[model samples]
Target: MYIGIPKEIKNHEYRVGLTPASAHELVAHGHKVFVETHAGEGIGFSDDDYRAAGVEVLATADEVFEKAEMIVKVKEPQAIERARLKPHHTLFTYLHLAPDAEQTHDLIKSGATCIAYETVTDTKGGLPLLAPMSAVAGRMSIQAGAHSLEKAKGGRAVLMGGVPGVEPAKVVVIGGGVVGENAAEMAVGMGAEVVILDRNLDVLRRLAKRFDNRLKTVYSTSKALADHVASADLVVGAVLLPGAAAPKLITRELISTMKKGAVIVDVAIDQGGCAETSKATTHAEPTYIVDGIVHYCVANMPGAVARTSTMALNNATLPYALALADKGTKKALEEDKHLLNGLNVCKGRITCEDVSVALDLPYVPAEDMIKEL
Candidate 1:
């Protein structure tokens, strides 16, 4: 099988989908790997490194996209790349199609086998491919929020970890999943008064146990979420609904009641945000003031730390890429039920239920589509 790795073209997104080590492994398995020139450069891997690993380098994205049977990518295809997609071509990436009607329509019309990394489930019902980036984004959420809270950044003129005799900033993290957990960990390490909210009692109990009472675990109800947000110096929106739009837990009215110059890092911005005021921002201009509250809603939080993000993402995604390369998408997905869950769109049909429901489209069973293929 011929596999392609294209340089990410998303605004300020510098992560590459594959690394030299990944190319080496695929080449060892008798699969041809075509990497777009400079794809791994931002991730600190040179073209020579890819060549050393026995992977061929292409000069343009068009060459890689046009030739490869399967394209392994870091992000969803942007408009131009989506136009380049061909029928039956396999696109394996983080396609957050639930909220983007245009992207959904484009993927549906492309007639491609689109497997979203974010939708892939493990045996334990965790998003395997999405977890690594989620972890990165979660950690970065605090870092970004902290910066946004600085006096120079129009924040409440406070530090996350205060000086001697001064109280640290209060951090409220919504959700206790991978994103919220990592956010709480970062905030706690920074000496902030950290509180995490989640509906799952078991998850909250586990977090309480793990944190040794250093952190507060609140049972997330509408009232609880509102109360925490009202007093939070920094609120991290980490909620997710796997392949669906993130729920608007923080309404505009709720944000209006927050402290003046409070910062909100909506990590769920990629899948639409958990805040009513959240709009996708870029790293260049990642924050905006709304109702005296600062909203930091960068869609690609990991992109700010591209090298670390690319390597971490490659580590998590390489195994699945190798599986697809070694066995083909059909054989690998058909054989592994977990991988089949990743199938968002296949042969021009919506195969993921959440995505279909979110977009108000028809949901077709992946097994049924596999049979047709």
Candidate 2:
């Protein structure tokens, strides 16, 4: 297998798909790796570094895309990159296609085999490939929300951890998954009045035990969301629905009724956000005011810490990449049901049920899709 890594072209996105160490391992297994020039430069890996790891460095993304059988990327292909995709290429990346009709159409039209990292499951039914970035985004949500709380940023003038006599800011996390757990942990550590809500009793119970009564765990309900969200100084929208669009749990009316100048960090913005007012923002201009509420909805939060994010992502994705390379795409996915779950689009057809249903497109079982090919 000839694998290609392209430099991310998304605004302010700097993370590379594979790290030098991971590429070296692939080379050791007799696979040729091609990388765009300076693909890892943002994360401190030089062309000489890639050369030492036995990777051929191409000068342009066009050349890299042309030279490899599989295209490994950090973000979804932009319009130009998507145009470069050939029918024979395999695209392995985070494709939040459920919400983006343009991207979904482009991927379907390209006739390439697309595997989304965010949909890949483990035996434990957790998104193994998405978890690392989720963890990063979760922890950063607190940090970003805290910054957005400053008065200059159009937020209520408040400190996350208050002074000796002042009360701390209240934080409400609307999910108890990886993102919510990490956000709660950070908020609790920062001495905020933290409350986490989720529909799953088991998840709520787990969070309650993990926090050890330091934070409140509420059974998520319409009333609970209305009450907690209205009083919260900072709200972290961390809900997810795998490959489907995130539910709009925070309504526009809810935003209007919330405290003036409150902040909302919608971590689910990658899947179109959990807030009605949330639009995808970049790290460049991470916040905007809607109904007097500051919204931080950077779609690629992990890319803000490119070096650490790249290494962490590679640690989780390298094993699967190796399996795909060693056995070929069809054979590898046919062998692992969990990996097959990652298949969103293959050979111009939708293979992910959530994505298909979300987009109102035809659905084909992943097994059947691969078998037919």
Candidate 2: tens digits of C-alpha lDDT, residues 1-373:
9999999999999999998899999999999999999888887999999999999999999999998999999898999999999888989999999999899989989999999999999999999999999999999999999999999999899999998999999999999999999999999999999999999999988888888999999999999999999999999999999999999999999998899999999999999999999999998999999988999999999999999999999999999999999999999999999999999999889999999999999998889889755
Compare the candidates by lDDT and give the number of the best one. Answer: 2
Model 2, TM vs. native: 0.99
Q: State each model's C-alpha RMSD to the native.
A: 0.9, 0.7
Off by over 4 Å in 1: none
Task: Determine which window of 10 residues in candidate 2 has minimal summed lDDT.
Answer: 364-373
TM-score of each: 0.98, 0.99
- For residue 24, what is the lDDT in candidate 1? 94
- Candidate with top TM-score is 2
